[model samples]
Target: MPDTQLTVTLSGEGVGDARVVVRALEQAFGAPDELPSDEKATVHMATFTGEARAEGSPTAPGHLSAPVAVTVQGAPGAVRRASETLARAFTTRDEGAASGDQEQERQLLLEP
Candidate 1:
């Protein structure tokens, strides 16, 4: 089991209702902390808030905005890399990218 926590910004049109948002988050996290989703992995998570962002010039009639945010959690050490482990998930450059130990050697558990 992995408890990897990470954060990234999501941009989309009409993110939808709270229920839909929670469902989306559960899908994103790959599991449910306090709800149900389609993911098979259990990565407990919670989103505090997602404030709408205003886009475009002030004079423009049509503008769009997406909520930017910070997420926190823990994941596999091999799959996560850095000089130091994250101190309570804050933010990441992006998701599904090799963010740790890009060149570390792999050894069998029973080797040593």
Candidate 2:
């Protein structure tokens, strides 16, 4: 099968919280193909190639308690897997009902 590329973007109050989310994503999808960098030092973005797996529960220790927004785009299966992984790490309520196309992309607002 062809590789599936997933892009995850995190934006929130503390960069540490974003970093924690990234670590969780890495555990699910393996190391990111493109790691986040400080372009302007506000938002964090990373990309991974492949379907995600739930290896284990990811924890954030010493991370700031703040709100986080995560966007994941990839194949439908990969997106679903990533969404499930993220839901475990952060408290998320569905932003809106997803349509068929929307299912391929997930947008989650997370709270600590």
Candidate 3:
């Protein structure tokens, strides 16, 4: 099977909040290609390349200070897995989603 790749774009909060979300994603998708940098911008992005964890030790979800808007784009299964991972880590409000022949995208609002 092709490697599942997930691209996550985050905004609304700062790097600290972004890290929290990234950490949650790491639990399922493993480490991202790179860590979230301190770019002093409103948005941060990371890409994870691997399969989602179906069996592993569960960890406590991290806390968020303010709401974070997350946009995930990837293969259909990868998008769904990442969205589910974020939802499990924080309270998420479904914004909307789109689908193509081979890829899917979803937007979610995560709150403390």
Find the candidate with the highest lDDT and give its number. 3
Question: Which lDDT value does model 3 have at 44?
Answer: 93
Name every residue pair that clashes in candidate 1. 3-74, 4-74, 4-75, 5-73, 5-74, 72-89, 81-100
> What is the per-residue lDDT of model 3 for residues 26-73, given as tens digits with 9 covering 90 to 100?
888888888788859799999998666664665765789999999999
How do these models rank on TM-score, best leading? 3, 2, 1
- Name the 10 consecutive residues with the lowest summed lDDT in model 2: 94-103
Best by TM-score: 3
Candidate 2 pairs with clashing backbones: none
Task: Return the number of clashes found in candidate 1.
Answer: 7
Q: For model 3, what is the alpha-carbon lDDT of residue 73? A: 95
Better of 1 and 2 by lDDT: 2
Better of 2 and 3 by lDDT: 3
lDDT of 3 at 8: 93
Model 2 clash tally, residue pairs = 0
Q: At residue 57, give the lDDT of candidate 3.
A: 61
The regions of model 3 sitting more than 4 angstroms off are none
